[model samples]
Target: MVILSGLMFIGISIGLIAVKYKEAYIGLIENRTDNLQTPSVLME
Candidate 1:
């Protein structure tokens, strides 16, 4: 029984970490897109 509980806890932790990583990855892509769309006045 103890081993089963430990396995469950590990699984939950991994799932949460995976979700957080995916969110951070998406946010980075969005920031890159925003940077590309804005024109630099210094360049003009």
Candidate 2:
């Protein structure tokens, strides 16, 4: 039971990290584009 809980916690953390990483990646792409001048409010 303890090991299962620990694995669940780790999985949740990794999911969060993946989401943040994807958002950051999209932000970088937007920053590079000349058409997008507004900043992403979600990141801030």
Candidate 3:
């Protein structure tokens, strides 16, 4: 019973880590897209 509970804890931790990773990846992609749409240019 103890082993099963330990395994369940590990599984939940891994799932949470995966979700955080996905959110970070999506945020990075969105930032890149926004930068591309509004590029900065120097005015002379």
Better of 1 and 3 by TM-score: 3
Local accuracy by lDDT, each model: 0.94, 0.88, 0.92
- Give stretches of model 1 more than 4 Å off: 40-44
TM-score of each: 0.78, 0.71, 0.81
Q: Whose TM-score is higher: candidate 1's or candidate 2's? A: 1
Per-residue error at 34 for model 2, in Å? 2.6
Which pairs of residues have clashing backbones in candidate 1?
A: none
Query: Candidate 2: deviation at residue 41, Å?
Result: 23
lDDT at position 10, candidate 1: 100
User: lDDT winner among the candidates?
Assistant: 1
lDDT tens digits, residue span 1-44, model 3: 99999999999999999999999999999998987788646521
Worst 10 residues of 3 by lDDT: 35-44
Over the stretch 1-44, how does candidate 2's per-residue lDDT look in tens digits? 99999999999999999999999999989777834566656657
Candidate 1, residue 6: Cα displacement in angstroms equals: 0.6
lDDT of 2 at 24: 100
lDDT score at residue 16, model 3, on the 0-100 scale: 100
RMSD of each: 1.9, 7.9, 2.3
